[model samples]
Target: MDQDGRDQNFSAASQVNGDHVEVVVTGEVDMSTADALFRAATPDGVHCATLDLSAVTFFDSAAIHAVIRLADRYPGALEVRPSPQVLRVLEISGLAGQPWLKPPS
Candidate 1:
């Protein structure tokens, strides 16, 4: 865990698997919390970054921007599995259609 991971308001954990990394996120993600998501989404030399937002309970536009920033930073290496709440926001923000954002199965 990095310093950013220590944020008590938000919790993010990352696991590296070969060329890919999976980041699990929970709690609210807003302007104040998006930085943690951004830090968690960092590729850190991995070819792929997957954001597991299955536990996210709340999010805002900043959360959407955090995902977009990850996409811009990593190009086609970003994948997102958003929770129901996060999914609604992503859909409203139109980020759900991005090629980098994998649709929930």
Candidate 2:
């Protein structure tokens, strides 16, 4: 828990496994909440970060940018599990084929 809960529209829960960290993200992810997600993922010290966006109901470009920036900030260290809707956004934004995004398995 950080500051005012209502101010941050997204929430994250993290679990570490070996050299990876699974970060489950819930709620909307937009300009207003992207920073929170960034802060949450930046601290785990795990080389690999998996963002479970299955629970995410909404995602904006800012959110996508946040993910991309984090991936760029730590190349080969970020992965995203975006739902079909979110994936569509990423694809439309020309970021779908990036190696940081793991194919659903």
Worst 10 residues of 2 by lDDT: 1-10
C-alpha-based local distance difference test score of model 1: 0.81
Alpha-carbon local distance difference test for all models: 0.81, 0.80
Best by TM-score: 1
Off by over 4 Å in 2: 1-9, 103-105
User: Candidate 1 versus the native: TM-score?
Assistant: 0.83
On a 0 to 100 scale, what is the lDDT of residue 66 in model 1?
87
Per-residue CA lDDT of candidate 2, range 1-105, in tens? 245545454688878887777889988888878887887777655677888887787889889878977897678788899877778788889988998876566
Worst 10 residues of 1 by lDDT: 1-10
